[model samples]
Structures are given as C-alpha cells and as structure tokens.
Target: MSGFITALFDPTMPFVRNAALAGFLSSILFGILGSVVTVKRIAGLAGAISHAVLGGIGMALFLSVRGIVPGLPPIVGALIFAVIAAALIGVVSLKAKQREDTVINAIWAIGMSLGVLFIAKTPGYADPMSYMFGNILLVGGRELVLLAILDLVAIALVLAFYPQIEASAFDEEFATTRGVPVQAVFLAILTVTAVAVVLLQTFVGIVMVIAMLTLPAGTAGYVARNLAGMMVGATVLSWLFSFAGLALSWELDLPTGALVVTIAGAAFLGVAAVRGLKALAKRAGRRAEGRVAGQEAGR
Candidate 1:
C-alpha cells in the first residue's frame, strides 16, 4: 500500500501519471458514449467497430515499416479505419435493415484479416499480443493528448444533440415526426462512437474493448433513472473499476488491460447476481402473500 501510494505521488514516474490520466479520460468517453450505445441497442455494432480497428493498426505499422507513410502514426490509421467502419455500419444499419449483421460481420472479419496480413508481411517482430490484449502502461504523452481531444469532441457533440439523440434512441417515429433529423443524428452518434472505440482500444485492445464499453454502462443502467444519470453512474463505476484494476496490476505484476476488463466483468456479474436474487426473493414474497390471501378467504 505504501509503495503504491508512493508510485502515484512520485513525480519521477511519468508513466503512472499517464496511466491515471488515461483511465480518467477513457472513463469519461466510455461513460457517455457507452450509455448512448446501450440505450440505442447498438452493442453489437460497437463490437464490430472495436474489432475493425485492428485493420488500421496493422496498416499503419506496415506503412511505417515500408517508408510509404513514415510520419503516419498507428493511431491515425486506427482512427481512419474506425471512422470508415462506423460510417459504413451506420449506413448499412440505416438502409440495409435486413442484412446489417451480415455486412458488419464481414467488415469485422476482413479488417482483422487485413491486419494480420499486413503484420505478417512487415519486416521484423510486431507483437500482436500488445495490440490484441493491450498495455495501458505503454500509453504515452501523445496518446494522452489524443484521448483528451476525443473526450472534448465527444462531450461537445453529445451535449449539442442530446435531445435529438434521446428522441431518436427512444422513439424514431416520434423523433422523425418532431423533425429531429434522425438519420443525421444517428450517424453522428456512430461516428463519435467509432472514434471513442479506437481511442479506448489503446487501453483494453481490440478483443476486450466491447466488454469495457458495455459492462459498466450496463451495470449503471440498473440504477440510473435517465440517460444523463446513466452516464454519470457509468463514469463513476468505470473509474472505480479502472483504478482498482490498475492498482491490482501493479501489486500483482499482471497485465493492466486484462486486469481492468476482469475487474469490470466481476463487478458486472456481481451486480447481476444481486439483482437476480432480489427478483427471486420478491417473487417468493408475492407467492406467500397470495397463499395467505387465499387462506383468509377460505376462513
């Protein structure tokens, strides 16, 4: 405990500070965007976006190695791929109606395969595990800045169009009748979500990003009275899970991203179990009350 506290406060340890900042920023994005995703029932779409980011990362790494785009960062490639994937998915979801999953899954698989092909063709060793599982400790100052910028963008867009998002998410017919520009707003949300997913992939990697995005928000859904409340609750829960995961990773010498996801998964399961038990107890109580009422009527 003492060592952990010292590491957090130690000015010499920039990585620790970076991790803390990354966690906080990521939680903000996850909390807000995730609430919208959950409310809109777009978790599968979010999963597809997260997985597709791998293609961008692979393409970036390949370009960097081949000197084709020496200045292009992996995140840039990831950002581009994510946005494109999100846009395509958004369009398909809007128009394809019956074949949305078919298109999304195809994109998801092709993106991952494209990534693998690029990585395989690149010279020297490219650690696929790092991108697949994530290494939050590897997050640096530049990535921190990028995350901050994304947070601003997400917050601004969400705030500016909260009414439209709420209307469209809950009732598309009503929203359209009210002239809410449902398609535009929905596409905007997807774009924002894609960006958020790419940034978060830095922390939890491609495979685990969906869990990180959905679990906390899903947990928050149980207690929050509204979308705003859900975002707030999810943010708080995300912070708790992230901090605890980081601490545990430090103490136990574990993978930071995996630990973070595990912590979230555990919390989600716990909440689900508690809710289940409560529901079961309530049902039992109702049955008992019914039995008593019948006995009294017989008397």
Candidate 2:
C-alpha cells in the first residue's frame, strides 16, 4: 500500500501530475471566461472559434510537411488562425448589423471546411483526431507552462477590464453612452474568447469546448445572486467537474473529453433542478401565507 501511494504521488509521475494540473487550470480559466460569454449571449461563439481551429491546425501541418517551420507546433498555428477568424467574425458582425449567431455559423463552416481541405491535402497527417477531440495524455511540460501563462494573462485581463466588460455585457448601449469603448471591449472579448477556446480545445476537443465554457458558468449563474459570486462559483464548479471527470474516465475507460462534458452536464441539470425546486417552494410558501391570512380575517 505504501509503495502504491508513493508511486501515485511521486514527483517523477510528471505526466499524470502535470496533466491533472493543466486540466484544473484550464477548467478555472474557461469557467471565468464562460461567465462573460454566457451573459453576453456569446456561448455559441466559443463553438465557432473552436471549430475554426481546424484552419490553424491544417496550416501548421502543411508548414511542417514543407519543413518551412520545423518546430512550430500545431497549437500555435491554431491560435493564430483562430484569433484571426474570431476577429473577422466580430468585425463583420459589428459592421453589418447581422445577428451574432449568423456570423458565427458562417465562420464555423468556412473555417472547418478550410481545415479539412488543408489536412486532406497534407501527407502523413494522422492525428487530426487529437484536435477534434482532446487527448489529455498528450499534455506535457510545455503545455503546463503554456497553461500557466495563459491563465495569468486571462486573469489579468479580466481584472483590468472588469468594469467595461461588465457594463458592456449588461448593456452595450448604456456602456457606450457612458463613454466606454464598446468596440474595443467587444474586440477584446472576442480575442479572449478565441484564446480561451483554443486552450480548452487542447483538453476537451473543439466540439466540447462550448460545454466547458458554458456549463459550469451556467450552473453558477443559476445559484449566484451577483456577477462576482457567479464567476467564483463557476470557477469552483469547473474545477470540480474536471477532477470528477478525470477520475471517472480513468476508472471507466471512457474518453476524457466525453467524461468531462458528462460531468458538466450532470452539474447543469442538478443546479437547474435545485433552482426549480426553490422557486416552487417559494411560491407555495407565499400561497400558504395568503390562505392563512384570509382564514384569520374570516374568523
């Protein structure tokens, strides 16, 4: 038993330990970002940006095949392309007055199609699945460092721009009237969303990134009375879900992304149920009070 415990917690088990830490960090980052995404009704944008990563992944693969970039990782390419795609979508949506969802769908389709074509043209590209559906086992020391840096950047940005983001999210016109830079705030949100989506895609796949971004935040929103509480609750919920999913996947031989998403979904449903029950109880209590008051008056 002692040997087993030592082996499990050993520093030499960097693979498992680092991967777990990365997952936890990713969950917290995404959860915080997800709050803004949900409040702004941009949860679907995460999906769009995630799918758009295919273009970056494909570009990276093409570069590697030609040896134009020897050490340029696919994720780097994905981040660049995803950011561009997200910016383009934001610009187009803002300029044309089109609904955000319409712009998002257009970006998603084009980016994914482009990525697929690029990958098809590339030779010996066998691991597109990792980008489509995350492989936690593939995370390494570099990824851990990257996650740490990104987390710092994300947290700093949120802290620095909290007021603008909060006002814009609640009311864009009101924020603009107050002399806030609405366009800049909107763009910043998109940029962060793109980066967050890319980071999460490494662990949850592009398809599941939305779940990671929105589920925990949505659950937190259900129970929180204020935006600050919502963000804190969301981060905690995300971490819990990630840890639970990791353990369950290991024990059940399930796909890690799927397990993580399942845990998030369960949390969402549980929170919704609790909220519903509370509302029902509140209504019942009010009705009972009214009935008792009527009886006393009649007597």
Candidate 3:
C-alpha cells in the first residue's frame, strides 16, 4: 500500500500516469462499445474486425520502411483499415446474409496474411511480438489524446442513438416497424466497434483483444436490466480489471497486457461460477417446495 501510494504521486514516472489515463479512456470506450457488441450478439464479428486491423499495421510498417509515406503512423493506418474493413464486412453481411461467416472468415485469414507479408517485406527486423501480444507500458501522451477523442465520439453516438440501438438489438422486426433503420444502425455500430477494436489493440494486442471487449460486457449482462446498466457495469469492471492488472504486473514483473486480460478473465469466471451456484440453489429450492406441497396435499 505504501509503495502504491508513492508510485501514484511520483512525478518522474510519466509512464504510470499515462497508463492510468489510457486505462480510464479505454474503460469508457470498452464500456460503451463492448456493451453494443455483446448485446448485438456480434462477438465473433468483432473478433474478425479486431484481427483485421493487423493488415493496416503491416501496410503502415511496410510503407514507412520503404520510404513511401514514411511519416504515416501505423495506428493511423490501423484506423483507416479498421473502418474500411468494418464497412466492407457490414455490407457483405447485410447482402450475403447466409454466407456471412464464410465472408468474415475469409477476410480474417486474408488480413492476417497481409500483415505477415508486409512485415516480412519491410527492410529491418521488426518485432511483431509487440503487435501480437501488446504492451501498455508503451502507451504515450499522443495515444492518450486519441483515446480521449475516440471515447467522446463513442459516448456521443451511444447517447444520441440509445433508444434506437436498444430497440434494434432486442427486436429487429419491431425496430424496423417503428422505422428505426435497423440495418443502418447495425452498420454504424460495427463501424464504431471497429474503431474501438483498433484502439484497444494497443492495450491487449490482436490475439486476445476480443476478450477485453466481450468478457466485461458479457459479465455485466448477467445483472444489467438495460443497455445503460450494462454499459455502466462494464465500465466499472473494465476500470477495475485494467488497474488491478497493471498493479499486479508491476508488482510481479509480468507482461502488463496479458496480466490485464488474465485479471478480467478471472473476474468473468468468478461471476459465472457464482451465478451458476445461485441458479442451482434456486432450482433445489423449487424442488423442495414442490415436495412439501405434495406432502401437505396428501396429509
């Protein structure tokens, strides 16, 4: 506790402060975007979108190394690629309907392959591990600023379209009857999710990014009465998991990103176990009540 307090106030440790701010912004992003992604039942699609950002990173790396647009940052490339991929996937899924999985899987594979090819072609030795596994310690002031902007956009959009989003998520036909533009809303949601996935990839990397997005929101779903409740619960959960993981990683000398995911996973499992036990207890109580009622009737 003493060490934690000391570290919290230490001015020399800019990385620690950056991580805190980034985590807060990230929590907000995950809260709103993850809620939408989970409630819409598009976790798999979101996973594909997250992985697809790899292609953009590779493209940026290749371009920068080859002296073609050397000023381009990989994150910018990722943002562009993510949005485009999201748009493409949304259109294909809307039109192909029955073959959506086939399309998503194809894009998933292609995106990963493209990333590998571009990185391999780059001049110097580039460690793909950072992109593959993530390192929150690398987050700087600029990334934090970007995260803040993205969080604001996500918050505004979610607030503006809450009713439509809620309506569309629960019942497409009903939402459509009410003139909610269900398809458009879904596409918009995917676009936003794509952006969030790109930003979050900086924290958790590509392979495990989907967990950060889905796990907290899914856990929140167990008790959340509405979309708003789910987002709030997920935001709190995200903040807790992020900071706890960061603290644990610092104390244990573990990989910060992986530790964060681990903490979130453990929390999710704990919630699931408790909920399962409660359900079993409820079932047992019902059976006992039925038996008691039968005995009383016989008496």
TM-score between candidate 3 and the true structure:
0.94
In angstroms, the error of model 3 at 27 is 0.2
Return the candidate ranking by TM-score, descending: 1, 3, 2
lDDT of 1 by residue, 1-299 (tens): 45766898899998887887888888988898889999999888988888888889999999999999897788888988898899889888988879998988988898888889989988889977788888777789888898899889988887888888889999999999999998988888888788778888966687657876799999999889999999889988888888888888888888888888889999989999999999999999999999999999999
Of 1 and 2, the candidate ranking higher by lDDT = 1
In order of appearance, the predictions have TM-scores of 0.95, 0.87, 0.94
Q: Which tens-of-lDDT digit does each residue in 1-299 have in candidate 3?
A: 35655675789888877887788889998888888889888888988887778889999999988999977888888888788778878988888878888878877888878888899999899777788768887788888888899899989998899999999999999999999999999988987788778887966688557877888898898999989999999999998888887787777888878888888898899999999999999999999999999999999
- Residue-level lDDT of model 2, residues 171-231, one tens digit each, is 9999999999988988888887888788768666885688878899999898789677788
Ten contiguous residues minimizing lDDT sum, candidate 1: 202-211
lDDT to native, each model: 0.86, 0.80, 0.85
**Which runs in model 2 stand beyond 4 Å of their true positions?**
1-8, 66-72, 125-127, 280-299
- Give candidate 3's whole-model lDDT: 0.85
Top model number, TM-score? 1
lDDT of 1: 0.86
Alpha carbon lDDT at 251, candidate 1: 85
At residue 109, give the lDDT of candidate 2: 87
The alpha-carbon deviation from the true structure for residue 131 of candidate 2, after best TM-score superposition, in angstroms, is 1.7
Q: Write out the backbone clash pairs for model 3.
A: none
Candidate 2 matches the true fold with a TM-score of 0.87
